[model samples]
Target: MEKVILASRNKGKLKEIQAILEKFGMETISRDDAGIPEFEVEETGTTFEENSLLKAQAILDEAHTITIADDSGLEVDALEGAPGVYSARFAGENCTFEDNNRKLLKELEGVPEEKRGAAFVSVITMLFPDGRKLVARGECRGTILTEIHGTEGFGYDPLFLPEGENRSFAEMAPEEKNRISHRARALEKLEDMIREKCSC
Candidate 1:
């Protein structure tokens, strides 16, 4: 199988990416797995596309191989799309997942369910040593629940109730979640692009 360097250290993100790419005969490995020294790539981009490309390009430069990266976050309509790019640090730098969730709930306090519309967005960028680049975006519409739901998944999963689903993302099984997540949709598009535009 073809191996690709993934410019992310989040284990949940890694599992989601791996589950999708494996079906395409591709394997993804973290920078550490490739023996690359640990380093932070500042997300200096204002948009998901920019950040995804920045990380992918950084990895490509270091490994001189196929590299993939994705930038994903929650965009709550009530918050005017706040915590989009800053989703990871929604509470504050070095905050825990619970802290971010608490902050989100606090922000949405007293907001009606009708006004709780939200969407999870993912932007995937792939870079090749031959100067080829591909970008794909995907989104899943949902609403922010009044309270935390389940214990599975990461990030904002506990507070996100995907449209048409009674349970929050955190309440769904991994296989079920992987089948319909924003990352899964983005990866599907990326797979199509790879099959059509590149040999790998």
Candidate 2:
């Protein structure tokens, strides 16, 4: 099987990407697994695509192999996308998931439910040692809830309800959420691009 390095240390994300890549007969491993030392890459990009490429390129520079990276976050329209690229650090650099959620709730306080529009976005970038690159983006539109719900998922999952759904992403089963998640959609597009490239 083809081996690829995923430019992330998050185990939850690694598992998700591994599962998807496995179907394409590719084995996914974290940078640590590939013997690359853990390090932080400052996300100086103003957009998801830029950040994703930054991460993938950073790892590829170190490992000189096929690497995949993604930058994803919640964009709240009510906050004028206040947390767009800063979703992870919305509360602060050292913030925890709960801290971020608390900040979001406080900011949306008194905002009518109808005006609490938001979207989860994911941008995936693949980089090869030969300098080849592929990128894909996906979004899931929804509204931000006044309170958190469900026990599953991380980040802003509990506070965002996908459109046409009564339950938050945290409320759904893992498989169910993965089916319609922004990351999943982005990976699907990435898979198509990979297949096309392989055939070329």
Candidate 3:
């Protein structure tokens, strides 16, 4: 089976990516499983594509295999995208999901529903040792909820309701949300690219 190494240590992210690839009948390994040494790829790039490409290339060098990397963020309109690339450490280093979410809510307090516009952006890139690469982006446009809701998902899911839906992402079931999530959408595009070009 063809295998993929996902360049992330986040279990939740690993799980989601693994499941999607598996559905396409590809084997996958999480970062821990890939036996990579401790390393950090600086996300100094301005755009998501640049950051994801940097990470994927680093992992391909270390693993010598098809590796995929992603960088995602929550962009709030009112904040003018205050926490786009900094979503993970919005509150500070070692910040918890609740910590970031709490701060977002506070900053968004009293912001009317119409102006609470936002969207989740995800960029996924795949790199191989042979100098071949593919990149794709997915986005979920939604309004930020004033208060958190549900407990199904972590991060800003609790306060995000995808466009045309009344329920927050945190309230969505795994399969349900996966079908419409920003990452999922990006993965779907990658899936198509793989099917068209990579499948043997």
TM-scores for the candidates: 0.90, 0.91, 0.87
The Cα local distance difference test for each model comes to: 0.90, 0.90, 0.88
Q: Pairs clashing in candidate 3?
A: none
lDDT (10s digit) by residue, model 2, range 1-200: 88899998889878888877787788999899899987899999999999999999999888888899999999999888879999999999899999999999999989999999999999999887777888989999999998999999899999989999999999999888988999888988887888787532
- Sorting all predicted structures by lDDT, with the top scorer first, yields 2, 1, 3
Per-candidate alpha-carbon RMSD to the true structure = 2.0, 1.8, 2.2
Model 1, which residues run further than 4 Å from truth?
A: 10-27
> Largest TM-score belongs to which candidate?
2
- lDDT (Cα, tens digit) per residue for candidate 1, span 146-196: 999999999999999999999999999988998889988998898788779
Clashing pairs in 1: none
**Candidate 3, residue 123: how far the Cα is off, in Å:** 1.1
lDDT of 3 by residue, 96-130 (tens): 99999999999998999999999899999988777
Q: What lDDT score is found at residue 102 in candidate 1?
A: 98
TM-score of 1: 0.90
Per-structure clash totals for the candidates: 0, 0, 0
